[model samples]
Target: MMPQSFETFNNIVNSSPVLTDRFSALVQDTISAAREQHGVDLTIEDCTAIAELRNATLGATLDRDELDRQMLELSSLSDSKLKADIAAGDQEAMAVALQKVNAGKEVVHYERSSDDRARRISMARELGIATPPPVQDDLRSRAEKIELLQEVKNPAQRVALARKWGLL
Candidate 1:
């Protein structure tokens, strides 16, 4: 048998994709505090994890907008891969491809931040920490591969991200 509240939370998460970290934190914090107040032996790790999840989810939402903007810039500046491939035999095409490949590569880096944010969110949530909505598990799961993912946007995000990655 599962805890009713836990199951309720799962259902809420599954159904809502727009819950923000602030909201999730409020919910989780309230529940955890209640549990603690009532004599449920909660550890520092548990409290830390929930706090981290809330922070990570919030960070991911903030980064998502920036990532989307960067991606748009990359798309506007880079030659389409298909066009580059078609022009492969032409020196001009090759040049274009090279330029696009280089330019787009930089823009592609936006994923690093987004991925980092996602990973932090996922890890925190998975550990029974509360998380905000708009959390992308795929991003979080593979965040380790991204170099820029570790950059913290704010003090809260920084602490949460560190805890999510076990850096703190």
Candidate 2:
């Protein structure tokens, strides 16, 4: 049985001609490459998974683009705010403005990191690399595992969980 969320996403993609066309092209390419390069006949499930990864990578690209635009806007605004704070000699306001700028930079950094990971995973899938199946553990629900994974800041730990989920 298809998960409800995936069914909904599929319906949304189907509704959009552009998205449907893109997915069809990606699926065909992946299928052909897998057959030729690995002598592997991909199942429908494998094709679907690869398409989903590609979609996610596309989303991350869009997100990064938007973040770049936002950062530019924020930089312009911050420059004006900093100048005003400096002219007014309000050290506290200047500090606050700088902090906000730093926060935005941090957000951009995080988003870029996420986008890099998505791109890597998508590329790996496209190349027909065999990903390990998710490990079976009694302690954590899928949602909990995902939540924990996101909270982890350590690169090694994050990679471990990503691999466990066949995302690396």
Candidate 3:
């Protein structure tokens, strides 16, 4: 159950156009479901709780366009810094360049993962599922794979494992 008061819920919903739209679309259905399944007419508070649950269960709403815009800006900034560092032609600059490259890769990977999660959540909602899809496999991040590679004494075996994981 939502612990928030009706006024708090109203404030929240009013602050976000997305939430307002979602609440508007969901309220009637929520009320009907409560009446049919629970044999109780929902109060305004009850309806808000149901809407909040549905929203929360799916995941936070993301503005993909805004996220993409920010990512592009960050990538541009990183690339400029990396190029300048490489152009300096010093050992420290070279190390900084490598770090920048790794950081950029990490950011891109994170963005892609967030996109995948949002896609899965959207798909689940479309299929009328009440819960987000279960993760089916344990996947290691690139950094974890790199750390694991350091433990492998055989260089050839390390390369093979890296290739298998698409880290090469």
Candidate 4:
């Protein structure tokens, strides 16, 4: 059985506007089935209430606008003007930037507490792309082949694509 005091989880499931009663009921039934299969001591009442909570969250997901807004807010906090301020060496900007950065960190901590490294590498990889490398390989023929392959439209065209791209 799931934890009794999954307060946030409860709130998410209960309060979502998009989750219909029927869908919520189905999810509750599924949870109950899993519990019963595992010999969990969950009561019918627990499933009913948890189903309501879960429904609320699921319902909210039906609205794409809300999801988009939330994604925008998250991205804004993580990779917005605040990061620029920090890069420019401004102390006041750095303070504000740190707050934005910390806010993003807090969200990540809560949402992905179980898989910390998963998000770290992705974020680092994205940020690394904007920074220029030390050298510019202008005369590299390998880079040209890779670029040509990237432009190819068909699967067959790409099937025989060469691997000679950059300094090996």
Candidate 5:
């Protein structure tokens, strides 16, 4: 099954979205700790029930201003996740939100095929790596053929472009 939403993570009502890297160990530890402290073994589900009871007494009885502040914090964190095509205003919010995510993450790139041979040769030269000259085709270059076909209108020109660009 899919994981629970992050908004309900460790919630008093549900505990399905455990974000720990070692979830089984965390669950076992919670159960073990509860047994050690209370002299009764408590499963993860039982621990969740206790949390609900704790919220019933503690959260329900908070002072008005404190409750309002706490509710504001909870609402920000527990609101629904963003959609793919967020509204324009939300997109701006997401851009700011992204600034807080994955800063300085490393990225790796792999080499491409010889079709980019000309680009690679220039790059190697700039990096001071000795490189052999590129093997040039006797006929018109690929870019030239593509550029030549841009204004093509006649049916025969399409066939000519196809054959020249080897799309046939």
Candidate 6:
């Protein structure tokens, strides 16, 4: 079974405005499944926010019109009037080009989150891309390892366990 990351879950909500009550139930089920199967050690606060923000950024398509207006207002100025725009340096352009840059950043920030890497992985897998499995949850400690190894009597099993635990 594929794992759903918070990011992919957010995408599902954002992609559709008309979600059903069943979607909430599904999210809960996914949260349970991820916790059980994927070893995603999230704080309660993180889980709470993930449940809340599942739809929070849905309508967050940065106001491109406002950005364009800002740019147009800047462009309408005479080159001599705006010192920042005509400093004959790319840095100057960058300083004045904040409107588009900032809005584009908003789109990117909306599209992904550090907390959503799992969801992104899920999406990638859905697209038929190969994804590495989540790192295994190794619960064995040194003492536990020794205890486990003490029972290895068969030669083949010993070799297999040794290779698995890097004993050889």
Model 6 C-alpha lDDT versus the unseen true structure: 0.45
Pairs that clash in candidate 4: 13-53, 13-54, 14-53, 16-56, 16-57, 18-59, 18-60, 19-59
lDDT of 1 at 136: 39
* Candidate 3 local lDDT, 89-128, one digit each (tens): 4557556544433343444566497775565555333322
Question: Which lDDT value does model 1 have at 134?
Answer: 35
lDDT of 1 at 33: 45
Local distance difference test, per candidate? 0.44, 0.55, 0.55, 0.48, 0.42, 0.45
Q: TM-scores of the models, in the given order?
A: 0.16, 0.31, 0.27, 0.24, 0.21, 0.19
lDDT of 2 by residue, 16-43 (tens): 8877786676566656755674455554
Q: Could you give candidate 6's per-residue lDDT for residues 67-108 as a string of tens digits? A: 323323322222222333433444555444433223334344
- The local lDDT score (0 to 100) that residue 10 gets in candidate 5 is 50
In model 6, the clashing pairs are 5-118, 5-119, 7-116, 8-119
The Cα error of candidate 2 at residue 122, in Å, is 32
Residue 124 C-alpha lDDT in model 3: 34
Which model, 3 or 4, shows the larger TM-score?
3
Best-matching candidate per TM-score: 2
Model 6 ranges off by over 4 Å: 1-137
Pairs in steric clash, model 5: none
Ranking by lDDT: 2, 3, 4, 6, 1, 5
C-alpha root-mean-square deviation, each candidate: 24.3, 22.3, 19.2, 15.2, 18.6, 22.1
Candidate 5 lDDT, tens digit per residue, 22-75? 344444655564456334454444433333223433234424354333332332
Task: Kindly give the number of clashing pairs for every candidate.
Answer: 3, 0, 0, 8, 0, 4
- Residue range 91-161, candidate 4, lDDT tens digits: 67655544433345555646676565555545443433234343555675766767777798986657544
Runs in model 3 lying further than 4 Å from the true structure: 1-6, 50-168
In candidate 4, stretches whose alpha carbon ends up further than 4 angstroms from where it belongs are 1-64, 75-123, 129-136, 140-166
